[model samples]
Target: MHDPRVLLDPATDAVRKLARRGYDLDLDALEKLFSRRTATVSATDDARAESNRAAKEVGAAAKRGEDVTAARERARELKARIGELEEQQRALAAELDEFLIGIPNLPSDELPDGSTDDDARLVDTWGEPPAFDFEPADHVDLGERMGILDLARGTKLSGPRFAVLRGAGARLERGLAQYLLETHTERHGYTEFSVPAIVNRPTMTGTGQLPKFEADLFRTGVADRELFLIPTAEVPITNLHAGETLRAEDLPFAYTGHTQCFRSEAGSYGKDTRGLIRQHQFAKVELVRFCLPEQAAEELEVLRGHAETVLRELELAYRVVTLAAGDTGFSARYTYDLEVWLPGQGRYREISSVSDFGTFQARRAGIRTKAKDGTKGFANTLNGSGLPIGRTLVAILEQHQRADGSVRVPEALVPYVRFERINPDGTTS
Candidate 1:
C-alpha cells in the first residue's frame, strides 16, 4: 500500500515515482476524497473541543449556584454532534483505506518501461537446450505412453486442466519437492515450514492476493468463516509473522515451504490446457524472505541465485529475465522470471518467479521490525518459487527422454528416487 500522503501531495518525489508506473493518476478524484476526509476529521476535532468546553461550562454553572439546565442541554447537543462526526470519520477512513489497497506498488526505476512480457529483458542464460536425436515428444505424449500421467482420468474425476500422476510419475514429483526443500533448508539457510493449505481472508490479503485477485482463488466456507485454498506457500509462510514485531537481530528471516497450490485459473480459458503447464492443482516449493529496508535490492539477487541453483544442480537449461514494469506482479516492485528450456515445446516456459516487494506486503501485513535506535518500520518482503514441481517434472521428462522411451533421473535427485532412470516398462534401472 502506498503512503496516503503521497497521493495527496502531488509535488512529492513519491508521487512522481508513482507516475512512472504508466498509470493515469486521477489527481482530481484523489484530491476530492482527501478534502472530504480532511473535512470530516476537522469537524470531528471541533465537535470534540466544543463538547469539552460545554462540559466545563456545566460544571462552572453548577458551582456558581446558577441554573445548569441550559449548559447541560448544550453539552448534550455537542455530544450528539461529536458522535455523528465520529461516524463520518470512520466511513471516510474506510474509503481511504480501500483506495490505498487497490493501488499497485510502484515499479522500481531500474525496471524496463514496457507493458508486456515481450518487453521483458533477458539477464542471463545457463546451459543450452538439449539437442534431440529424434523429434522430442511433449510431456503429455511421454507420460501417457509410460502409464504415468493420467489426464483422461483426471478429467473424469474433476474437469479439464486437472492431472493425476501415477506410480513413477507421482514419486518423481515427490522426489523433486523433497530435493528442493532440502536444498533450500540445509544449504540456502532457509528454515523449512509446513503451513496450512487453507487460510483466512486476512492471511490472503496480507500477501496481496485477496480483494484484487479473488477470482483466481479457490474459496470455501468452513463453518462460519470463509477460507481460501492457498495459491502459493508464499501466502502462509510470509504471513507467519503478521501483526508482530521482530528484533533488529532477526532482520533477515528466510523460510521455505512445499505445498499444494490451487488456482481457479479464471482468466485463462483455452491456453496451455494440455499437460501440466497450466493446472488447477500443482505442487510448489516456495521461498520467502523478510529483511531490512536497505537490504531488499541485494536480497532479491541472493534469492534469485538460490532458485537458479536448483536448475543448475539438475543441469537444466534456463534463462533469467527481468519482468517489465507493467508485467510485474501486483505486490512486487520488481520481478525476475526463470524460464526453463523445454525441448518438447521447442521454447522456454516460466518455472519460477523471484520478486522483491520492498515493504509493500509488510505494510499490508502489519509486519514490522524494531531498529537498533528504537525506531520501528515495516520490513521488506520477498518470495520466489524455488521451483514448481509440475513444470520441473515437465522439463525433466522432455529433456532426459531417450530414444528407447526411458527417462534419466538427474544426478541431484537419484538418491531421493532410489534409481538413476525410469524405463518405459515401469522398472527402474
Candidate 2:
C-alpha cells in the first residue's frame, strides 16, 4: 500500500507513477477527500480542546460556589460536537484507506513502458531446446498414453480445469516438489517450512491476494468463519512475520515451503484449458524473503537465480524475462518470469515468477524492522515459485519424451524417483 502522504506531495509524482501500472487515479476527488479528512481532523481536535476547556470552566464555577449550570450545558454541547467530528474523521480515514489499498504498487522506473506480456524484456537465456527427430507429443497425450494423467476422470469428479495424476505421474510430481525444497534448503540457505493451505482473510490481504483479487481465490465457510484456500504458498510463508518488527541484524530472512495451491481462474475462461498448464489444484515450492529496503534490488536477483537453479538442475532450457510496467503483479514493483521451453508446445511457458514487493506488502502486513539507530521502517518482501511442480513436470515430460513414448528421469531426481526411465508400458527401468 502506498503512503497516503505521497498523494499529497506534488513533487513525488505519485499520480503519474501509478498511471504507469494501469491505475487511473482520480486526483481531483482524492485531493478533495484528503482536504476533507484534514479539515475534519482539525475540527475534531479543536472540538476536543473546547470540550476540555468548557469542562474545566464548569469545575471552576462549581468550586467557586457560583452558577455552574450554563457552563455544564456548554460543556455538554461541546462534547456532542466533538463526537460528531470524531465520527466524520473516522469515516474520512476509512475512505482514505479504501482508496489507497485499491491502488496497485508503483512500477519501478527501470521497467519498460508497455502493457502486455509481449512487452516483457528478455534478460537472459539458458541452455538450448533439445532437438527431436520424431513428432513430439504434448504432456496430455503422453501422460494419458502412459496411464498416468486422468483428465477425464478429473472433470467427472470436479469439473473442467482439474486433473488427477496416477502412478508415475503422481510420484513425479511429489519428487519434483521434494527435490525443489531440498535444493532450496540445503544449497540456497532457505529455511524450509510446512504451511497451511487455508488462511483467513487478513492473511490473504497481507500478501495482496484479498480485497482486490478475491475473485481469483477459492473461499469456503467453516461454521460462521470465512476462509480461503491459499492461491500459493507465498501467501502463508510471506505472512509468517506479519505485524512483527525485527532487529536490524535480522535484515534478511529466507524461507521455502511446498504446498498445494488453489486458484479459481475466474477471468481466464477458455485459456490453457488442457493439461497441467493451468489447473484448479496444483503443487508448488514457494520462495519468500524479508529484507531491508536497501537490499531489495539485489535480493530479487538472487531470488531469481534460486528459482532458475531448479531448471538448470533438471537440464531444462529456459529464459528469463523482466515484466513490463503494466504486466507486473499487483503487489510487485518489479518481476522476472522464468519461462521454460516445452518442446511439446513448441514454445516457452512460465514456470515461475520472482518479484520484489518493495515495502508494498510490508506496509499492508505491518511488517517492519528497527534499525540500530532506533529508527523503524517497513521491510521489503519478495517471493517466487521456486517452481510449480506441475509445470516443471510438464517440461520434463515433453522435453525428455522418447520417440517410443518413454521418458527419461532427470539425474537430479533419480534418487527420489528411483527410476531411470518411465516406459511406455508404465514400468520403470
Candidate 3:
C-alpha cells in the first residue's frame, strides 16, 4: 500500500514528485475524506465540551436545588451525538484504507514507459547460439523424438499446460535446480533455505502476489484458512522480513530457495502451449535480497550475474534485458530478464527475471530496517530466478540437440546426471 501521507501532504513540490511516478493520488477523494474526518473530530470535541459544560451547569442547578433535570438531559444528548460521530469517523477511515489498497505503486522515474516490449533493453549477450549444420528441431519435437517429454499423458492426468518428463527430462530438471542451488550457496554468497510450498495469505500478499495476482494462484480449500500454493520461492523468501525490522548491518541479506510453484494460468490461454515453457507446475530456485535503498540497483546487477552464471556454466547462449515499465512484474520497479537461446525454436526465451522492487514491496509488507542512527525505514527488496529448472531443461534439450537425434547434456550437469547424453534407448549414446 502507498503511504497515505503523500496523498494528503500539503507541500506542492512533494505532489509534483508523486505525479512523476504516475500517481494522481485521488487528491479530491482524499480531501473529501480528510474534511469529513476533521469535521467529525471537531464536532466530537465540541460535543464533549458542551456535555462537560452542561454537567457543570446541572451541578450548579442542583446546588441551587432547581432546573437540574433539564441540564442533565442536555448533557446526555451531547454524549450520544459524540458517540455517533466517532462511529462515522471509523467508517470513513475504513473506506479510505480500502481505496489505498487498490492503487498501484507509482512507477519510478527511471522506468521506461510503454505498453509493449519496446522500452525493454537487451544489455548483454553471452556465448553463441550453436550454429547447426543440420536443421534444429524445437523442444517439443526434440522431446517427442527422444522420448523425454510426454504431453499426452500429462493431459490425461492433469489437463492442459502439464507435462510428464520421462527419463532425462525429469532428471535434467532436478539437475538444473541442484546445480543452481549449489552454485549460489557455494559461490554467490546466498543462504540456502528450504521453504514451504503452501503458505498463508499474508505470506502471499506480503510479497505482492496475492490481492493482485490471486487468480493466477492455487489456494488450499481446506486446513489453513487462506493458504495458497506458492507461485515461486520468491514469495516465501522475500517475505522473510515481512512485518519485521532489520539492523542496518543486515542491509544486504540474500536467500536462495527451491520450490515447486503452482499456477492456474487462467489468462495465458494459448501462449507457449507446445513445451515446458508454460506449465501448471514447475520447479524454480529463487533468489531474494533485503538491501539498503542506496545499494539495491547494484544488488540487481550482482543478482542477474548469478543467474547468467548458470547459463555460462552450462555453455548455453543467453542475453539479459531491462524490462520496460509496462512489461515488468507487478512488484518490480525495474527488472532485468535473462533469456536462453533455444536452437529448436530458433529464438531466445526467458529463464530468469532479476528485479529490484525498491521500497515498493517493503512498504506493502512492512519489511523495514533500523538505521545506524536509529531511524527506522523500509528496506528495498530484490528477487530473481536463480533459474527456473523446467525452462533450463527446455533450453538444454533444444540448444544441444545433435544430428543423430540425441541431446548432449551440458558438461556442468553431467556428473549429477551420471551421463553425458540422453539417448532414445534411455542409455548414454
Candidate 4:
C-alpha cells in the first residue's frame, strides 16, 4: 500500500509519480478521517480521566463526613459519555485500515512516468527464430499429431483450460521444471525450497495477488474461508519473512521452488484456449528474492540472467522486453518479460517474467531490517518464473519438430528424459 507520508512530503515529489500510475490519492479524505479519530480518542480519554478524579473527590468527601452526591452524579455522566465515544473511535479506525489496505504500491523513480503499454521498450532478442522449410504447426496441432497430448479427453476428464500430457509430453514438462530449478540453485545462488501449494489469504494478499486477482484463482471449495490454492510459489516463498526483522548480514535472500499453479482463467475467454498456453493448472519453477532497496536494480539483472539461461542452454530463441509502468505487475516497480520464439505461432510469447517489486510487498508483509540507527522499514522484493514448465514444453516440441514427425529433444534434456527424440508413434527414436 502507498505510504500516507507520500502525500505529505513535498520534497518526495510523489504526486506526479502517483498520477502516472493512475492513483489519485485523497489527502483531504484521509485527513478528515484522522481528525475525527483523534477527536473521538481525546474525548474518550478526557472523560475517563475526569471520572477517575471525580470518584477520588467523592471518596475523600465521605472520609471527611461531607456530602458526595453531586460528585457521584458527575462521575456517572463521564462514564456513559466515554462508552459512546469509544465505539465511534473503533469504527473510524476500521475505516482507515480498509482504505490503506486497498491502495496500490508506489512506483519506483526509475519506472517511466506513464500509464500505457506504448511506453514499453523492446530490450533485444537473445536468439533468432529458426527457419523451417514447411509451415510449422502450432503446439495444439503438433502435440496432437505426435500422440503426446490429448486435448479432447482432457477437457472431458476435467474441463476447459485443463490438459492431459501423455507419454513424452508429460516427461517434457517434468524435465523443464527440473532444468530450471537446477539452473537457479546450482549455477545461480538460490536456496531450493518445497512449499505448500495451498496457503491462507494473508499469504496471497502479501504477494499482491489477492483482493484484486481473487477471481482468477481457484479457491478450495471445502474450506474457501481459510485457504486458497496459491496462484504461484511467489506467494508463499516471498512471504517467508512476514512479521519479522532480519539482520543486515541476511540481506539479499534468494530462493527457488517448483510447484503446480492453479488459475480459474476468469476473464480470459477464447484466448489461447486450444493448447497448453493458457491452462487452469500449469507447473512452474519460481525464483524469489528479498534485498536491500539499493540492491534491487542489480538483483533484477542477475535474476533476469538466470531465467534467460534456461532458454539459451536449450537453444531456444527468445527475447526480453521491459514492461511499461502501466503494464507492470501490481507489486512490481519494473518488469522484464522473457518471450521465447515459437516457430509455429510465428511470434514470441511470454514464457517468464522477472520483476523488481522494491519495497511494495515488504511493507505489506512487515518484513524489514533495522538500520544502524535502529530505525526499520520494508525490505525490497523480487521474483520471476525461471520458466513455465507447460509453456516451455510446448515451445520445445514446436521448435525442434522434424519433418518426419519426430521431436528432437534439446540436447540438455536428453539425460533427464533418457532419449533425444520422441517419435510420432509414442516411441523413442
All-Cα superposition RMSD per candidate: 1.6, 1.2, 3.6, 2.7
lDDT comparing candidate 1 with the true structure: 0.90
Tell me the number of clashing residue pairs for each predicted model.
0, 0, 0, 0
TM-score versus the correct structure, for each prediction: 0.96, 0.97, 0.87, 0.90
Show where candidate 1 strays beyond 4 Å.
11-22
Cα deviation of 315 in candidate 2 (Å)?
A: 0.6
Q: Please rank every candidate by lDDT, starting with the best.
A: 2, 1, 4, 3
How far in Å is the alpha carbon of 412 misplaced in model 3?
A: 1.5
What digit string (tens of lDDT, one per residue) describes model 3 on residues 92-151?
A: 877776676665555555666664566677799999899998998888888887787899
Ten consecutive residues with minimal summed lDDT in candidate 4?
109-118
Give candidate 4 misplaced runs (Cα > 4 Å): 12-15, 38-83, 112-118, 221-224
Off by over 4 Å in 3: 7-25, 34-86
Lowest lDDT sum, 10 consecutive residues, model 2, at 1-10
Per residue, candidate 4 scores C-alpha lDDT tens digits across 162-186 of 8898888888877777777777888
Best by TM-score: 2
Residue 119 Cα positional deviation in candidate 4, in Å, after optimal superposition: 3.9
| Model 4 residue 351 CA deviation in Å | 1.2
Each prediction's Cα lDDT score? 0.90, 0.91, 0.82, 0.83
Which candidate do you rate higher for TM-score, 1 or 2?
2
